[model samples]
Target: MARAPVRSSQAKVVSNILEKHGYQLGQYLGKGAYAIVWEAYFKKWRTNVAVKVLMKDKAEAEFLSKFLPREIQVWKGLKHPNLINFYQSIETTNRVYIMLELAPGGEVMDKIRMKGACDERTAGKWFEQLCQGMAYIHSKGVVHRDLKLENLLLDQHDNIKISDFGFCKFAATDVKNLKQVQLSETYCGSYAYVPPEVLQGIPYNPFLSDVWSMGVILFTLRTGKLPFDDSNLRRLLKQMIKGPIFTQKHASISLECKDLVRGTLASDVHRYSLHTIFDHPWMLPLVRERPPYLRDMDALYLRPHLRRSTQRLMTIRHTDGGTRSTANLVSSTRLVHPEALRSPSPPPSPPAHRPPLHARPPLQRSWGGREEGGRAESERERERGRGLAKDGRRRE
Candidate 1:
């Protein structure tokens, strides 16, 4: 059955609230069963933010009464650089609005779809950030319960941001006098990422289940495929219960990487803790080179611009004229924001007439070939071009 739409009056009320708060709604970011996300400009702050609008009616009263409050409680207290930043929330007679830090770089799943498989170094960097973010949240007694690729977003700088707190729960509120570790019987998260125990309808440690999801992520990163992919739910569950994830012999990944994947995918009793995963030989190099966390000011300014650029690019790609001349448009955008090159499109082959946006100068290490400076240069050039071409009419 088709879901009911928010009443026109309710939507108008939401628009009024946004405008009253100095936010101008821009483009649709995405939608789910209960909420819709839009890119909006916060005029007062001179920043771009994502507004998640959730409709509240009799049908969704239970969700509004339970999950929404829990989500707000967890999001309001989170301050990690690798987790999505929640600015504030507003409530109305018929709806709720959540203002959030937008990650314009899109989901890790999109990147996987574009590049087939990620190089080990790139995957390691992302994995390290995921571990740090997960560790921070777990320390606060919250278990994410969902840790799939779609829930993992990337910022303009390629940093990971863990999102979607709808299924998040506190394992223990008071750690001082904890008598026993908390366990949850809730069956949540995506089917492919769900741990075997959760599928068996048994009480399980949420933290351990999260670790299993991470293991699935690592496997997908290396192979561009799920470890237990199947259309049949029963067959998939059986595969999850079976030991070992098969890796391609020809794939370029270290044995230590495979070992970590295997260990994280193990049953709850043998699953590695987040700390142990961080200390693993495969993750140690990234740990040693970890950058300082983003300050509040840095995030406040950078996030908006990135989101705006992403919206512009997406809008352009969808136009008929833009579709035909996508190469030039893509190159032009890349000239200004090299990170745009990594957007969900397949890795482009360099045109014979011109150098590709991703072409990099020789570097000291094979794995260090993807240059940050190159991306910065492209972005600068693209901005200049935009200024010069402002008078040109856009193709409809």
Candidate 2:
């Protein structure tokens, strides 16, 4: 399904609202089922930023009452070199706007599509960064259920910046005297990266499920293809249960690399925890790359063009006490803007002459499906999944 085109009047209304909030809306970046991402320039920060606008009327009740709030809470609590920075979240009656760090280098999956697989060094470097970021997320007790190549974004320096936390949730803890791990029942995330336990309809540790997805990501990075075919759910589950099979394509990858992949994709009991993964022989030797601020300090000091912009980024501090290169301090005490106010009043939408809801085109693919074969294949996969559920498997 495709998103209805934004009418000129609707665009003008959104731009006006953003302009009042100190942002100058630029080009349309992309759109999903109920949200649209736009490129905008922040007057105060003096840098390009991405704004994700979620249409209230279009969003489902579950999203409004559950996932959206969870995403905002988890995103705000996080601050890390490899994680995308969250600046501000604003709500008007008709829409919810989330301001975020702009990653100019685009999605990591796009790179795999254009060039083939990454070499050992390139894959290792990014994977190390991802592990560090995920470790931080777990320490904060947040589990990002949706972990895939498409969600791994890159900045101007080609550094990894994990994005999209729509399905994120805090790890369940014991209600009685102490904190303990609790298994999750929800079946979320892309089918290609989901672990076997999740597919089996059993309560599973989401942390381990995340580790499994990371294995899928690493394998694809090295081999330029999914380890198991996901065109059919029954076939996919069978392959996962049998475990990943090494082919001629995996022959060139180092022994230690193969071991690491195997360990992560292993059944829950044998799988390595994030801490154990960091201590693995394959990961132990790799040096985590320095962030841009530290790595390019000398060059930035020498060049005026780079120094001016870089210094500005380094100066702004989030209230969380971390020094981020690309985030602004959006604390209530520091600044107050009209747009930041969470008023219940509705903002104007397109004029009454706009097309009816049913008359509009269907929505575009959101964060849910993989883009390997584009929309046609995605729709077919959904149909097949529905058929499986009706057949009494009730796979969800």
Candidate 3:
């Protein structure tokens, strides 16, 4: 049955649901193009939940009516410890609210910025959780078309919760039934992390594209740099066609990690499986979720460990005994300033490493042209106040 649209008297019921559940929006977690996340409390669990308020736009209004109902249906039956829990969804004319697991640590990008890239052991743990999430999503027949560091959010315990399914698709269609979708294009998703096939506008295997996206994520996590950079898209595409090799020996990373990178970058269409890269022993620690006491690991190890107010999982501390600050990351998201946060579509795929079967968009050097000093792409400055881009670009 078609779920009744959220309007008129129903909107008030939505708010009542929140009040009834005793969850009050505490602080705004962050925002996306059409969504804003807020930290709220669940009186029953006495815990925090990330309430994703996906607003209704002229373009998205109709989509949400169908999308939200569909998402709720799908989420209702799915249960897994690793998966982010979807508590409830309520809708008003102004917004569709999805109550989700709150991961306060922010995106992996936040970690990259704070720590300048993590070590192999740290990177592997993340890789394992990511795959576990992907594996779960795959098991449910859902294709998370968009997978990036930003999409993978970290909990208070620093465990990742794979969120954001705005671009997801259910595998209920065959070539004949899905013909309409099979021909779809627009290179949707964060550009820098997009798979090659999607860029070429071809029918893509969802799982493979997701893993390729994962590789880009791993690359960014360990190297503190993008893989397939060039002066221009033409050059980038040429190198991609030719297959670029990445050697991170200068970065003081381990050979096992390098092997992982190589394994991740190896994109033979014939050799695709979660176990393909999943079999690596180094990835074991990450795939297994840390015990409930993980947040306390730092406390146990640090000379003067400070227990966190939240779940007491493994405590994480740098060699200096100071915890990495994710405060900046949590607040710096474009959602903080919705009117100014419209972004172009993310550079969807073809990481700095090997090119997928497709050529990528031009590598944008954010560093101003000759007008600016000889700053590389990383040095580009963004004004704090800009409107959203019609393209699905990231707010960054």
Candidate 4:
């Protein structure tokens, strides 16, 4: 695909601006549809950073004008160990530069591709991190419209960092107002990972869609394959809408893990909420084992003037009567503590009186399970009954 050209003048302008701000742009990292990432050295902080440069042209100016700023604003408010850190954004006449943390361990998808599949323990650890990250973002009233293996990067310690906010949007900031906020109907996301509601062209809750995508990721991690896969797009969509994601009988995975997947991939009524997923039998151990909040003291100790100056530049361009901007938008750049980015209290512990895993009733089943055969027969009978009723009505 042809990318927008970064002219020599624009390049020099960006370079001078970075130099003025005590940053040295280094080697090229990667490129996407609208941006190019480069390794950069921040002389002031004495740390390596990833700089994402987005070129602007007349053709895409309007779209970039709205999207780029929203992305910057979203990143500025988010600070979590499992999320990619955003430093600042620099905008010029023809380009926008985003400073971010560099994840040298590369993408999770690459690792999965190399190993085919991961053990349940490893998958559980990664899934915990993914959930924590998602929880943080959702708490901030943002929904990552796209959550897949490819967008998950790893740090040196093998910790997951959720990246790529191009498709993210603010859903709701106030808990009480959640139902009143307009639901998103935009059809966007990777086809293989998209939820049934989205594919059916219904206005869907973005958070639920994100949860579905996470379920897809979990399934991929366990089996190294998509839960719903087919060459024909229509066939794949049909399978997704028809219900049930059949796991291979030979795949060695526990029922608890399968239950989590089924719960997440279930219809809206039966789907597990993000908070509920955290307390699930398969997730409780990993959640309790989460590492302590690793604080970057330097960020908290940033010079007051420097912080104020950055905040002044973080302008949120508003179009339409307060309808376009995210709710609870941080107008003033307050000193964000690591603790402030997360919930003030710890996550709730699982109930002490809960039954052991083996004793509990089977959770919702997607495909092959103890009751799979019975469920299949039941579904067939229901379908036949519906067909006969339709035939009689037509005859009448």
Candidate 5:
């Protein structure tokens, strides 16, 4: 059976529910199998926030029982610059609402899709941030099993914000030494990002798998393509076992960059640890320039659709004798964040070198009238004609 599209009626109902809690739902952001995300204005925060809503009835029992709880547990405690900020979570009788920091810059994948692959410097800058975020996550004994380009988002400043904790797990630790307890047996996450150990159905280190996923992301960012083709699952597993084959397609990437990729995607025994990746020669230079910010050139890769939405949000309403801009409305309501008003593209400047008002020609109306000085000129002409007629009459 075909699934129905998100109904406007349903959205209206949800919007009302959110309003009761001091939130006003804006446009639809995105959705997954179990949840829908919306851009919303939170009154208390006086900021625009992302709200993830999961319907209890629609979601799977397994998610409700296991993954959802784990995600919330992991997300609530995390505090890092690169990680998305978790505001709060609310549970009602039939739904669960999770509020999060909205990254205005949108997804990293959006940039790649809009423009081709990122240049080496740009890619390296983001990759370094990703590593830092992962390092922090691992330190907390959490593993992000679903790492991918799509999950990495950018904020207004264009710094990476790691998001989506649905598949995350707290790594089991031994009590005596407080070291890792055992390998994760669950084969979960996107097939394209999963490593060979995960594909072989063997117990695998979740942290290492995440690193492998990061490697895949880096490769795609540099080459504009996934390292391995996954059309044939059987062949893909074999190909992964054989290791990623570097080709002429990858010739543009530096030797050091290739070395990092090779290290991360290596066999389970030889896979590069997150610590090792941080210390690698390729990543060393990028480390100094930590917490990378977006450059003017990088702005070209930003999602156009998001830019349009931002412009729409800040649009001014013009009416006769009354002008009410969205910015004013936001201020009055104390709803939208100031960031929402910022457009990626600057407003067009007025044309340079305007003629002096007296020197400028009067605008002529198409229906045989002057827009400005033409009326005065016409009146003078009429008076002159009448005087000429009077003179003729006198002479007669």
Candidate 6:
């Protein structure tokens, strides 16, 4: 008889492997159609990591055999600091998990939820960073077709980490037969973020579709939601299929944000490229001046579990311990004393009782007889642990 293939996942074993690899699970961040993300820590670097656990099921054959490999390939080709880091992959007999750079800030959507809408300054800045990341990926010949608030992750210090490359394409190689590839049209991505050309039968420019998505992101960021109105998929698709014009509810939005959305959302086929939208005046300042805030906002909102990743940036790290960068490194910035950037303190430490069993002993034990010796030893161990934790901080 043939040997049986493994059944029932080794969840605990996989979890242990993650911990051993310096990844400690923090929380259940989110899950989508294929994978679940757990906030984790990479102890080696004292940073957070997003562990994407791909669910294994008989129905997930297509994702595992096809899309997963493509995602890995696209990620491996990418090397920008602003993009989310894809660390390593965990393979078991049945399931798969990928460890990634955790964004401490959370998601861009959270920012909108917190402040209603981002100001022009913030929106522009973020868009510029989006450009940088997109440009980098595009330069590498990859097009992130799905560019939206939900997919754009953030790390501590507010840096954007473009994520979910599930729908990404290796443009340089994918266009092996441009005619066949371009002509093929099978829709994917969030309904709210799809572009007009995608809705029509036309062979769309992936870059332009990305631009429209970016416009949508900006509109939502500045106004707390999308620029369109629809209650169903067919209706939304029909509305998005039209020309690039958006009628703003003036009572609900500012003229400035709506204007940018109007100009950026055009489907004239000529105006949808990032090269065109990025050239706008409102976006120019953001292109030149808004990285820090955008990055910081990313940290505060999108990747809160992935802390300290943005604590030091090439932009500011070169300065003389200042927030600004100096002549040492061009355009690189770093976070100076980011611990100071912490949120309103966490719930006060659980009532300090006997130092938990797991805590390293910190005090000196007494070498007395029997009963007295036992009591003293326990006290000494805790004293030593507290001292060590304090000393480690002081040394830093």
lDDT per residue, candidate 3, 46-111, as tens digits?
Answer: 887777766677335445556556667776656665566778887767667788877666666656
The models' CA-based lDDT, in order, is 0.62, 0.66, 0.50, 0.61, 0.64, 0.52
Residue lDDT tens for model 6, 225-260: 565532232333444534233344335545655666
Candidate 1 local lDDT, 214-291, one digit each (tens): 998888787666676322334444466564455455257888998999889875655677756776888887784433
Residue 392 CA displacement from its true place in model 4, Å: 45
Tell me the tens digit of each residue's lDDT in model 2 across 1-396: 122245688677778788889988877777665778888889998898888999999886767887788889989989999999999988999999999999988878767765667899989989998988887776656788778887899999999999988778777463222134555777666666877666655556777888998998898888776776554444455566556667775788989988999999876666677766777898887756423222211111122222333333223312222111211100000001112112232332232342322233433333322232344344444444343221111112
Better of 3 and 4 by TM-score: 4
**C-alpha lDDT of residue 35 in model 5:** 67
Q: Give the clashing pairs for model 5.
A: none
Q: Return the candidate ranking by lDDT, descending.
A: 2, 5, 1, 4, 6, 3
Encode model 5's per-residue lDDT on 1-396: one tens digit a residue: 121233697687678788899898887776654567888888887899888898889876767878788889999899998999999898888889999999988777667755667899999989998988887777666788778776888999889999988777776464233254346766665555787656555556677778788888888788766676543334445455555667776789999999999898776556677767877899988895433321211211122223332233223212122211111000000011122113232332332454332234434321101112343344334324322221111010
Candidate 3 Cα misplacement greater than 4 A, ranges: 1-17, 57-59, 172-186, 230-232, 242-244, 248-251, 268-271, 281-389, 393-396
The TM-score measured for candidate 6 stands at 0.63
The RMSD of every model to the true structure, in order and in angstroms, is 18.1, 18.4, 16.1, 19.6, 26.0, 21.8
By lDDT, who's the top model here?
2
lDDT pick, better of 1 and 4 = 1
214: Cα error in model 5, Å:
1.1
What's the true lDDT of residue 362 in model 1? 24
lDDT against true structure, model 5: 0.64
Q: Model 3, residue 53: displacement in angstroms?
A: 1.8
Model 2: pairs clashing at backbone N, Cα or C within 3 Å: 1-363, 2-362
TM-score of 1: 0.69
Which run of 10 residues does model 5 get worst, by summed lDDT?
A: 326-335
- Mark the regions of model 2 whose C-alpha exceeds 4 Å error after superposition: 1-7, 172-179, 289-373, 376-381, 384-396
lDDT of 4 by residue, 125-165 (tens): 89999988987777666888777777888889999999877
> Against the true structure, what is each candidate's TM-score?
0.69, 0.74, 0.64, 0.68, 0.70, 0.63
